[model samples]
Target chain A: MGKYYKTTPWVIPELPQSLKNIFKKNGKKISIRKNQVISGNDETALFSNTEKLIYIDSGLLGQAYKTYCVNKPYAMSIVLPGRMVNYLHYLEIDNSGDIILALRKSDIFTMTKSQFDGITEKDLKDEMVRYCKKAVTSDFDAMCCMFTCDTPQRLAYFLKALAESFYDDISTMPLVEIPLKLSYAEMSYIMHTTIRTIERLLPKWRSMGYISTRRNSLIIYK
Target chain B: MGKYYKTTPWVIPELPQSLKNIFKKNGKKISIRKNQVISGNDETALFSNTEKLIYIDSGLLGQAYKTYCVNKPYAMSIVLPGRMVNYLHYLEIDNSGDIILALRKSDIFTMTKSQFDGITEKDLKDEMVRYCKKAVTSDFDAMCCMFTCDTPQRLAYFLKALAESFYDDISTMPLVEIPLKLSYAEMSYIMHTTIRTIERLLPKWRSMGYISTRRNSLIIYK
Candidate 1:
């Protein structure tokens, strides 16, 4: 029988020193628990830190899957009962320990309404598996492999790639400042934890100066 | 002399009653700060909100401006630092104070990086006036009418419209969830505020039972 090593359920001091430096400079701190999503596709990454690691404390991310069918690479979730689907689509899986549910594009209509209705983060992941199983399996495998490395190291690699994917060039005089759209609560879901639990750890980071808070946004400095 | 009112800076409330109801039922909350951006054309919203509002704290908006000699909308002031410029060529000024700064359609070489880099939100609005002076007297005058509403009212209106724009089929879904794509910090720049402020307010709403958190999205009670 293959030994199944469960993902740990603690907030490891895996954040990079560079990020800590920046966070301290900006007057913030860093600490992540399980069931917390650090980043996602189709959104501007927080702090532009490219070290990617799915910070999980207490939920089965492997079991939480979501999928979407878009006219283009558009996000398909919304916060209210409205007509437009924001581009919160695209999930990155990289661990056997992390849950990876399958999803199909054709089933968008079947799941979209429910997704909009108030599906739990776990349910969302389950629906995603039903929608895009093929695309995620590989990522899921990678996630499991990556988790073997210290959490911070894996996170560092993941974050750097994420930053490269979304960083916009400086030449264009962009009149509007586009922001990363996910909230701390939703992020907590991806990481598989409670909002209170996630919120609880933030102050620790703030005290350590590994992160900085500006109104609603948290700037990661590494 | 025309009475010039500098737009007062109003931070968007982290939770509204409507948002609270939705989050309580759905377990998610998606919000935008005053003067912060929700999304852009082709770029997708950072996060999906059941409804979205551009928190206009205090500043002129909707004055047509020129970058590469083309008239464009002026709203949030932000630009990515690399890669080819996307639909940023024209600015879309909505009547409800929602502005989409186009980047996909703009030319990459229109302005040198230094010129673009140094431009601030104030500078962006000023350019609009300079660009439209031939038909418009000043940037301030053209944008003043739309920028005069209180931040809460403006936010309310934007949320209503955003709801209609994304989810209108009320029969099926009980709550609305918006997929988000932005980080908290990026949102601050768009809203003309800081992340600390945002952090302080979100929990207030959660305590008031106005909003809830999800793993990768926000749920709003309709």
Candidate 2:
């Protein structure tokens, strides 16, 4: 599992050279442990960092949701490497109970709000808008899938999306490999079903030759 | 019900005078009929205009979702007067089957994409970013409520949020009124439940003094 846990570096296609230089110079890199709460709840009181932009260097991260009745926190909006996070919170739009969490041992990079403010270049601003737009689209896509699909189709869609996030050339891959170790309990929470349901479904899927598991990873055949 | 169909004008608090002047000069006001599809699906093919920003001047609007399995369209993320819309589509972020629709007879003001691009003022750009961030926050809040809350709580939360969008000052209101006419079927679709379930719950809610319906409007006692 560790051998498969490769972190892809962040790269925005067609990014202007000047903006890339600024990002390279100012962004600070950091490492986090698996299952760490990055932002929200009690962690928010200690969260005084001034970073405005967050780039995932490697590993899985997701939005940790705090519900009124649920004791354990559940995660959704799972993010992959080479993607960005925290633009909404940094902009002060989302002040709700949702928190960012590390799904696995991860590497991340950050850019301060002030650093973002200092950039007056039109091209850079346009690029940032494009990136933010992509994040919003992804949110809507996940919301649509959750609302429309059944548990099995939802699980399959989520797994395929996760695989696509990791695979740069998904068109050529024979077997899509998901590196993160997601438990049946977590899947149940994400899919809004019981753990018993997920446990019952996994073996059935395996028998159909649609999916298989090894160690902490899942592989879906194309 | 007809008397309650009032359209409020767009107003962003503490907006700069200079930017306001630009908006006043460039924005074009228009009206749309109830149940009109504003964007997405077949409407996208007919969409030829280049408007970049849509400010709800009066009436209700929502994201009309078309699913693969469902025959009827469902709506969520309901927008009210004084709120902004179309930034995601204008930025080309959302291109799925979700369409923006007029929930009631609606009046809106739009600024062309070129007109928006013409403004190089930093304050206006910041203001636009702030508006977009608010929309994103609303999406996240709705998603969290849907995932976490039970059916009754979810319906209550949705109604309260809808009222807040119409209220001038939620802090001072004893009873908040939702001005839109949402059918039980529509509510069921948005809540991911059956219309029978909504019918069963409404009378119980009215008896509890939490909510009451008059004609087409819903009044929520705070």
Q: How high a TM-score does candidate 2 get?
A: 0.78
- Tell me each candidate's i-RMS in Å: 25.6, 6.8
Question: How do the predictions measure up, each by TM-score?
Answer: 0.21, 0.78
lDDT per residue, candidate 1, A109-208, as tens digits? 1122233334345654454333333222222222322323333333333333322223433224232122333455554443333466557665676687
Best by the TM-score measure: 2
lDDT of 2 by residue, A15-132 (tens): 2355445555677777878777776555532242233466667787766455444643453666666666665554455545556777778887767656765764777776766665
- lDDT for each residue of candidate 1 in B60-91, tens digit (9 for 90 to 100): 22211211111222233232212111112211
| Reference-based lDDT, residue A89, model 1 | 30
DockQ for candidate 2, please give it: 0.37
